[model samples]
Target: MSTAIRPHLSKIVLAPMEGVIDAAMRARLTKLGGYSRCVTEFIRVSDVLLPKRVFMRLCPELAEGGLTASGVPVYVQLLGSNPEALAINAQRAAALGARGVDLNFGCPAKTVNKSMGGSVLLQEPDRVAAIVAGVRDAMPADIPLTVKIRIGYHDDQLLEQIVAGIWSAGASELAIHARTKFDGYKPPAYWATVQDVVHDRARQLYINGEIWTVADSYKAIQQSGCEHLMLGRGALAAPDLANRIANDAVDQPPMAWELLVGEIEEQFLQHDCNSPRHIGNRTKQWLAYLKRHYPEALQLFARLRTLRDVQSIASQFTAHRQQDLSI
Candidate 1:
């Protein structure tokens, strides 16, 4: 059995991919093992009070040990620049059975950064402190409040200072994305930067960025000497990658085609939409990274995109898979 450095840190956390890591994705990732925790995509924090249904929709697993089907605890992630509003919403989420709260400070979406939310907060360390303080104060003491952040907004000049501010503001832990807001998922995640933070600060560090394979993850752990890691695109690229890391095994991951097809069928089946069009579109988005795992994934996605409707696309996908299996 794998042991975590801290009880809260999962050896593998499915990165919070907006629109891609939905309830269905969460359920599938849970079954794959190796993932210890998962966070929903960032929910917009509005100045106006949100309806209760919104909270339920954001975290359906809260009713059952704050975990998805695979029993991994899922944290509800909130994204906004307003400290007070974010705090209020954090409390509401906790009261509604949320086990933990994750504040988003690293989202690089143009709309989000422009709205003074997500990675934009990195531009103002003091404001980030206030936001963390407010949410930490509002949430229950037992409920851990964590924050995810990039190095800086446009430059890394303030990265160390921002990390300090988050810690001072009562954040229980921090997951560093190992790059600046401007890096925008580009090449080279600056992993060494994260190692510097862990070596210098007393805080627990979870490495995120460019860890696509077991070897990549191992090298990161070796370089940083930090055990905890968070996989964003990596886990999606290979569902069983985490199991390989947790077991310290060198086995290649399971065939990506098998996992992706199964996840697509399972997620679409859960919806009541007149057709699976909406869900099918979601699958295409994930294929951005998933295809790299299985070359055939691109062909499958291309076939999916050609269809005009979800039902037809789904039928084609299923029929093709059945044919492949029979041969």
Candidate 2:
């Protein structure tokens, strides 16, 4: 082992990817082991307080005490610019059994930005602080309130100010996506920039973006100098990445592609059969990510890319699984 010092990495959070990583995916990924927590897709809160049904629908884990079947905490994520509205809905989530609430200030989608909901908020550090402070105060102190943000809006000019404001506003944890909104999921996350500004040892920090393998995680930790990480698309690309990183098995082999495809198929069949038009879209999205790691995933994606029906996709999965069994 190298003698250079490395982060202790006490937590690994499953990043909330909108239209992906829903309740079923959370359950499946957390079940495979080594995740400390999961976050729901951001529930868009506007001027009104959303109903209980909305909360329950986005985060079914609220019905299960804010935990997946595997017992990992699923923090309810809320996105909006209205501090009052955000606070009210956040408290509602807590009252509905959410153990933690995450405020999303990092989404870069044009629709979200135009609505003044996501990274657009980063342009105004005080507004971000107000939203975080308002939500934090409304919720029980015992319930953790976390904030997620990109490094900045168009540049890192306000990075220090933003980080300071969120912490000063009482956010218990801050997860930085490491890229400015202008960068938009591109390469060069500037992981080391986090170490340059955020120096508070009292609060936890999770570094995200461009981490798709064990080697990537290692470099992210060393460069960011942060102890915790948030896995986004990387988690889907390699479903066992959490376990691999947790165990420090840098060279550990990925889960067999056959077994992974089978698990994906089972989840799709169990939780995704209801919506006819959207039957195989989510599975295909996941396969796109998985293809980055497993050649079989690419081949499978090619096979199912043109198919949209549940029956057809399900049949392909059956053949895929039977072939694995025969092997």
Candidate 3:
């Protein structure tokens, strides 16, 4: 199979972050302009074949030809330990309109790892290979099959072997988070280590981790020698990080906190959720990350954290907008 890393393909991608970069966030971020593609949060696959509703719930972009409103493609990601089950779900995702399928072998959450899923598979390179091969075979050739993995579970000792197995299994692209499962979300992404293993592979290797700004993105590119970078928390913290990185700009010019809050409001209103509590929690979750970049966001989160009613949150956002206008 041909590699997905084409010579012309050098762009930033949104990382598949569970509970964060849902369909609403993807549409909002892509609309801001920068991300080349976005991956949905990992759809957990267990024993049975997941239904279309599950995929739809996770990635509503599937209903619109798998592209965000701004035209960025969204890939559906799956996480599980069973090879056949993963493949069956991958096939169903494709049939239901997933433009691409990404296999997740890099989630390091204790709960996920304990369940014999996520980065725990990194300890078993053979199982990773089999899972990737199964998914690759199950999906249509037109839809790209990608894999996301950490360097290793406990260490980078088997990094090379893991990469080799993933490529041999016919993954079109590979994203290395540049941290061991044990490393968690610490500083120092170990970008330099990936250089020794990449060594002229045809597959596209994306470097992800600890990139919080455009400067960090440049440093990651310099250290990893990879032009393609994936943004996770960094994008969440600074919503315009991808735009700045794509434009080769320094960083987003300071904007009013109310504008950012309004964007969040827009996203929340657009989302098709049955409960206002879900929207309220989602808004608070976004504000928690935004606090990293905007002090006002911290204040906003503090005010809204205890509120379960979406209308109350929206009222606060309205007041903030009015306050900004008054100023």
Per-prediction TM-score, please? 0.90, 0.95, 0.91
Computed on alpha carbons, the lDDT of every model, listed in order, comes to 0.78, 0.88, 0.83
Error (Å) of candidate 2 at residue 200 is 2.9
Order the candidates by TM-score, highest first.
2, 3, 1
Question: Which 10-residue span in candidate 3 carries the lowest summed lDDT?
Answer: 1-10
Of candidate 2, the 10-residue stretch with the lowest lDDT total is 1-10
Clashes of each: 0, 0, 0
* Most lDDT-accurate candidate: 2
Which digits, one per residue and each the tens of the lDDT, describe model 1 over residues 1-327?
Answer: 323222222367777888778777888877878988898888899686677788788778877878898788899899998888998899988888887899999999898888888998898999999999999998899998988998788988888788889989998877888888778899788877666667544336677888887777866665655558889888877877888777766555555566567775665556423454454666666665678677766766777765656667668667768765442
Q: Give the clashing pairs for model 2.
A: none
Better of 1 and 3 by TM-score: 3
lDDT of 2 by residue, 80-161 (tens): 9999999999999999999899999999999989999999999999999999999989999999999999999999899999
Candidate 2 has a TM-score of: 0.95
1-327, model 3: which lDDT tens digit per residue? 322222223588899999788888888888877898899999999989988899999999988999999999999999999888999999999999898999999998888888899999999888899889988988899999999998898899988888899889999888889999889988889988888778776238789999987777777776776658899998888888888777766634534565677687776666623484475777778888888888888766777777776667767766665663453
Candidate 1 — what's its lDDT? Answer: 0.78
Off by over 4 Å in 1: 1-10, 200-203, 256-260, 271-279, 322-326
